[model samples]
Target: MKRMRGLLVLTILCFLISSVTSLQAWEILQQSGFSQALGDIFFIDEQKGWATGYQGVIIHTQDGGKTWSQQKVELPCDSELYNIYFADDKHGWVTGSYVMGDGFILNTSNGGETWKIFKTKDMEMPYSISFIDNKKGWVCGFGNGTILHTEDGGKTWDVLYKPEKNYLWRQIFFENAQKGWVIGCESPQKGKFFDTIMATKDGGKTWQVKYYKPVADEDWWYPWSSIWFVNEQEGWATICKKEATLLYTKDGGETWTKHQFNLGSWLYSVKFINQKEGFISGNLADSGKGALFHTKDGGISWELTAEFSKSLRKIHFLNSQEGWVTRSNGYFYHTINGGKDWECQLEPKTHLHDICFVDRNNGWAFGKYERGGGLILHSEDGGRNWDKQRLELPSGDWQMGIHFMDSQHGWTGVSILGPNSTGAFLQTKDGSKNWSITEIEYLPQDIHFSDAQNGLMIAEIEGGPLVMSFVQTNDGGESWQVRNKVARDKELGGRRIPSRIQCLNAQQWWVMSSWCLSYTSNNGKNWTQKKVPDTSGFYFLDDQIGWFGSNRLYHTKNGCQDYKEQELPMPIEWISDIYFKDSQEGWCLGNRYYVGDSLERCIIFHTTNGGETWEVDLKSPQHLHRFGYASGRLWAVGDNSVVYGIATQAVSALGKQYITLGKVKTVLFQNYPNPFNPETWIPYQIAQDSDVTITIHNIKGETIRTLQPGRQRAGAYILKKQAVYWDGKDDKGEEVASGVYFYTLRTSDFSTSRKMVIFK
Candidate 1:
């Protein structure tokens, strides 16, 4: 009897460990590589610095700008941080505007380990910040020339100066407590504006105009993008216009001299290490390349030292040999040898517009870099990692559509925009190792392949009566033939243009334009038009069953002979893409719009019983453009270089349980007794039997521990005895330091991650 009892206990323990190890959830294959544009950068020394940008992002670097780690700031969504100032290592402040137009300041006392927010209700969007010490600072920006001052370390702020009614201060600089200068633009009337500079003598108590320049406002220039002072006697300001302009002051802003360079660039930030050396950062207006210039003779003559794909925003230099520059797309560079050479310290920034997969293990994502030029990313092993493929194209070109018939045959459309602008078809055999370009007469909007040799494309014609044309390739894209034309619709005020195209076989094709849906039964020779509410999304499961999406869902069962409106579980403003695996399972990509917000919230809706009903499957903060299904999984690609995958089989198996179990959804609950010392418990629930694992990561995204609890049956593990426990030790049984850490619960089909704090 004793041996039997011991055997039973061992059996239970083995089952417990194995049961906790299995589950499934949607997994992020590629992270959103820095979605927001960086606005400002500041370094207290050569070894420590901070940078701020949109979406309340604050990243800190300890070894200059070689590598950086994110610091969490609890702000509302869409908050824009514009400027950062550090009085020392432990005291710093960041200024920006909230989503509702109120300005805010983030103050940190423990070197950005924590932050306190102070909202300035009276200010309407602060842009620049200047500090002389830890307690005294000034912020200036949009509020009818309003300037704010803080003497008690951002706990309270008082309005210091308000200039004319239409003056928009851009930057503020202070040489000391009693003397300072502010530069901005002023518009006494609509459509006419000029640059203005003001000087203060009594710590912003009294001000006088030092210089003003009136222009015709032909191209609308923001006169002063940035301003810096080496001393009270010498200063410089950069201008944003068609040509790069630098303004130099020798007598404390009393008079200024203008120097112009024909670089066709917009200068943003200027910094000087001494009286005779300076650096300026900006972007070329034509190609969007980040530009850096160095001058040893102050502002007289400059040499182009470096150029990159993204636009450069801010520059911070601790001395002549060490400095950092930030890009508009959340990338910063470090230079140890002045401006001669620099190294990037972040992932490359690109926007993935369309994705295609020949099988489960082979795929390609097509888009453009944030700076310019075409980008193609290939992934093997189901998108766990991605590598870039080289396609020789101009900086002004971008890819639009991609289609693959197999692992070795593919074609992509390229839109060329420059002198003699047109489009071309890029065809590749042997798995994208080499591509040959075929020039076409119009821009290719969308392309679809029915087989290896038969393909259909919708092309847009410029400066012609024919708005769009249908092109066909019969011999594997070696040559193309124009088969039909879509004239501009006079009923819609000549605005109808083809946006998407679908091919079912060699004989049937469909096209969705802005105003109508057109289909042809005999390979694009003749077309029949059908009117729908809108043409945001369109999909055809076969020749018989089809769906169209606008603000509402419309379905057809017999090849568009008639339509019926379907109901959605939630409200969506617009549907961007639609896909159906069969007559019963489908998914739609859409957005929900709020009344006052400028951004659209993206959501994915899934249906198990066709168009009769749908349920919310996923929601994303980043914009998701397109998706595809392959190898029993759904893959999506979108803005910020993000790629996501989810197993469809997991959702199908949980369908019946969702009805019986009151719609139980997979959830990863917050850890108990957060900020605890040396111990914590993580609780979660799975909708189906799945492989489960929990990973702990530090603020720098380095994994510290991974707990595998085996395969778990469908149920809640929310009780303390049932939850996964951690002993606050790393993989090597060493104690972790006190800081912020992230814990992610991943299943075979679903995944959710959240942050936890360790205080001891």
Candidate 2:
């Protein structure tokens, strides 16, 4: 009976262990500090509120803006949840527009515990969504002046209105069921840009233009940003042309008041708890002062509340007294007694612009010129945690590219725009502990270093006619010279502007501008152009093999000498980037539409035997833009500053094989002839190319010799095909006095050591 009880307990423990281990863990989603540029915030009774922004990030705080928790939102790449509205804790609706295509609407029934995704027809980018109840709602944005209306709890939507040709609108608000208002810009040719607002009083039957500013607003660079309404008659709109203006209306848009202030900034959002109390927040257009403002007696009088260094993106108030705000620098601020006193809420951030990893343990990321945005971060523990490293460049400059060849050497290009727009190139010698700048004229469009010395940089020629100057730095960015100039030929563009570049080593590089694909081999000294129409992205595995990712997939095994276009099972819009470990393992990141789905999705395609056969690796709800591979780990980064990754051990080639793989996995076998006389064969197989190291250690944990080091691309895994022979030798090729020995196989995502007897 005692033995049976023990066995039953042991069986239960094993079951629990197996159940926990059986789940397929895809990847971890990390919300970096850059995600806090909250686009919109909604509060359900001061306690529960949801905020969404910067890549479809929707976070909920049950503690009155004191703490926020990130929800498990399965969004596609570049999915930005720009606006949110909640009727109550249990029912709510959210809206967002993706950069690639269409917008998204998400509904929750159990207070955001779970979300049911609803798709709208065609490619509609809904920026603002409003609801009178859970059943009746309206959405409006720039889908050729797009507007969607739903009455059945958003299960279905009808296109109620679409503006004529060049007109665009956003920021829709509905007070009760019959009255709704929207504010945006629309004007005729040779006519001044109008600050306009339209109203619908009888549901969706008719519309009226109620308010208009004949001249453009303060900032002429872009259209006005945001609008809000406490009720049908009382509303506020923030506009910027060259300066800033706050417009308020009282008599149902019939009469309005304008307040011009020297906040030296462009206001973005407005919120009012009642007709008598309100607040506004935004960023300074230039470097000035005064960001947040408060008014107790309506818009009659306003007072400066608080100021942030960067710009504010959103503002929300739970009651007349408690409020919350989010800024572009990934900061969250909350106020208890109105704006008299405020507190900062902290959240971890992972959003960076350019990221690079040198080994399994060393990595770095750079963003804009703010915290978690433009500063440099170094990780010694394989990106689990990061510490800020000072990068010396001109103040207010932003890093465009951060590339590293190894642990100790790297280069960064930074640019500051305006009248005094200057570009600086920075290089670090001792890893990323510090950075020093190099004089780079114009702007650095692309930066690459093939090795510790041979590197290439492409910068715009100073005071030239949109020309790209090829430059080289021989002594690691110590000095640079112009090799040649590639002028921005007008005939090459006037199609789709190519705003991206990729560099492979220093000798080979690829750049796409519009329909023109340019390649350079002699460090950009000369260029070869290929007019490939409808080109989106391209990846080259070697000088002779490459693949182009457009609406369809194209391959060129013999460099660009020959191209073959292949059609996919489903329609794909565009592919951003691609990576391949070898001819047998590859990945493609792009936007795709699957049959039976209402809207398109951001997807990842995996190929086993190069680009011969492909399958979906990940079909995400949020959009993923770029992917980085280092050591044996693949990391994906996108809109909301979120990071997703998979390590070597987690790499499962269930779809493709590497050279008629036996198990399609990473395998390390025990050395042959355990009690042999003088020599043995050490055999191992990895599914993909990884940094592999094999070391022998004695019983007291002392290193005996290193069998293999450096990068080993995916190779023949079967024994007798290719094997590493160990002649029972040490580093000096001497037979070691051995009793017990341990051999270890370590890579980025995988590591295992086996013990063996070394009898002599």
Candidate 3:
């Protein structure tokens, strides 16, 4: 009997594997319009090197910066990446900050094709990184000039030394495996803190202050930007002083001479291609254009090349003729004739966050629409004219959920849950042009379609006390019906209430909010809620393999029947969003999960095996708040109209395409007559939500009462969760503040923080 049972199980497993293999694969789609900014840069040999910055941004150059492709860094969905250093072509290090709170650090062994994020208890905002060899590296960030040293190729980190006080060490460089120096600032400064350089000789065991006093140009007030060392004795540093750019150096930190600026803009970057040739780029004093200067005799003299007048934040040179510079104007300039001339690269109307292309011809981009949504842009024409489009939405009438059956036929959900407004279930028979909208009642969150006709929609109910599931049909948009809840509802203590659904898909799906994941094969008809070890959103490339996104990552290859939790090295604790192109190509967003910090920096991570493991894609980093995959591109959207484009598999170009979501002038106010004797009404709009929170707070920002904080079926809400009549008391049944209290209503990711005066 035992043999028979084992044989049957094996047969079932094979059948399942075959079934999954037969399913059609999905591809990334188009994008909208937005802005793009850049950060840290590094070059291995002048021809092959990588740079990383905000939003896990990464970029690579193989043909010497003539063109670049976006690379991937191993950061989460919401980490505001900082710096990156490449030891050679294959080994590198990246650091950044978490959106929710804390810091991030990651390393790559495979030439940035993949990266592994390391963990350390003290891992915070590591703004800069430097790797001397394959196994020796250093990372610095936070308020302190804390230097973290790693010997085993980033397998581990040890605190070699912490500076006397907190200093923002922005950049670090190493000429050899043992000799290195760091450029930063001392804290508690009255105004502008000058560069305070530190050096270590014996593998970081002992350190000496290279320049204890500020550089002579301190009175000019330019923050130190970048540092480079041609050798232990011959090195240079760039500091943005007043209106002048200063390049100074020491015979190994013993004596320093500040170089004269060729232009008046703040020199953000300085690079030496050889001991003979170098370049500098930065903003052009009120010119509103970027300035680029080149030098053939090291830092001796400089010549102005092109002036875009915007902040040319970064510059990379392959040879003298072929180079590229990224500007703060949301554009990138490329030159094949060295820095003598330049031309601006244009992208679709979508604001790009980061960009990468495999070669001059083939590339990929990640960005978002300027209207506060995600987008993906592509270029088949050497970037002369780029095409733009939109990504799939989750649901609720906004086309939140989208899944491509092939390169053409795609299915996305049209959410229909707004304040007295409803949407449809849409299908693009011809690649997002003329569409169809099937009116539905439930507020959809995510949708997955296996083919053209069959699909599933994960939606929530009205009043949101619970979430509902449904198997949808596209047979002329005839009828849609509920299938089953992915799992039965259970409270924190088994008191059946309802589980708030965060994410859902077609094949191998899971629901969150109750810290439980349910698996279903028969289309949500029957679900087996698997008690997972992690407590956030669950993503599965298939029914068996999946990853948990939260404070840590819990992975299960055996379909949640069993799982293992892996603690991330990042100091933050929130994985905000995720995107997976295939089982192998995936991305994640993160926000800080601390108690009371509110800077939602963008963190992005990539994976190849679904979520079995993840690595930071440093090529395209930005502080993206949201992302989506559409057509053949990825879209990342965030604050300040910031976006990017990962041009191709091997190259990337930066640009901005602005778009407005159409003016929304109307404002929805909160409810009135709070703490009324009997009847009260709370008014709001249904923009987007799987959950909402309406709480009453006192003047001092204290939760005076919990009016309603849970799932609300999409639409305008004026309902009551607790008793409509209150005895004029707090939760403890004591008479609360009488005059002019406030009640605030918010949603899962949207908080109005609006106030309504409550009278006793």
Which candidate gets the maximum lDDT versus the true structure? 1
RMSD, every candidate, angstroms: 19.2, 24.3, 19.6
Q: What's the lDDT of the predicted structure labeled candidate 1?
A: 0.74
Deviation in angstroms for 286 in model 3? 5.4
For 235-324, candidate 2 gives per-residue lDDT tens digits of: 888765556778878777666677766654577778788888888886555665437888888778877887776677678787778888
The digit string of per-residue lDDT tens for model 3 on 79-181 reads 6666666767777777776543466577888888887877655754677777767897888765556788888988788898776665657677777777888
- Kindly list the per-residue Cα lDDT of model 1 for residues 1-760, writing each as its tens digit: 0011111010111001011121244456775356766767889887888988887889898976666688989986559998898999999999887654577888999999998998877676788888889888898886467888989988788989876565668889999999999888765533356677888978887778887776444434344477888898999988776566778888988888887766647888889999889999987657878998888987688888888777787898888888889876667788889878888766556777788888887988787776565667777667776766645456664437888888888888766555666677877776666666777776786788888888888776645524767888888776778887766443221123236877777788878765567888887778887776666678997777999866578899987778899976544556767888888888888754321222335667788888788876766666677786787777888877777777676663332333221344676766876645679998777767899999999978999999988898765565466689999999999988756688999999887787776643
* TM-score, prediction 2: 0.55
Higher-lDDT candidate of 1 and 3: 1
Model 3, backbone clash pairs (residues 3+ apart or across chains), number: 140
Mark the regions of model 3 whose C-alpha exceeds 4 Å error after superposition.
1-29, 32-36, 41-53, 57-74, 189-194, 212-224, 286-288, 329-332, 343-760
Clashes of each: 27, 29, 140
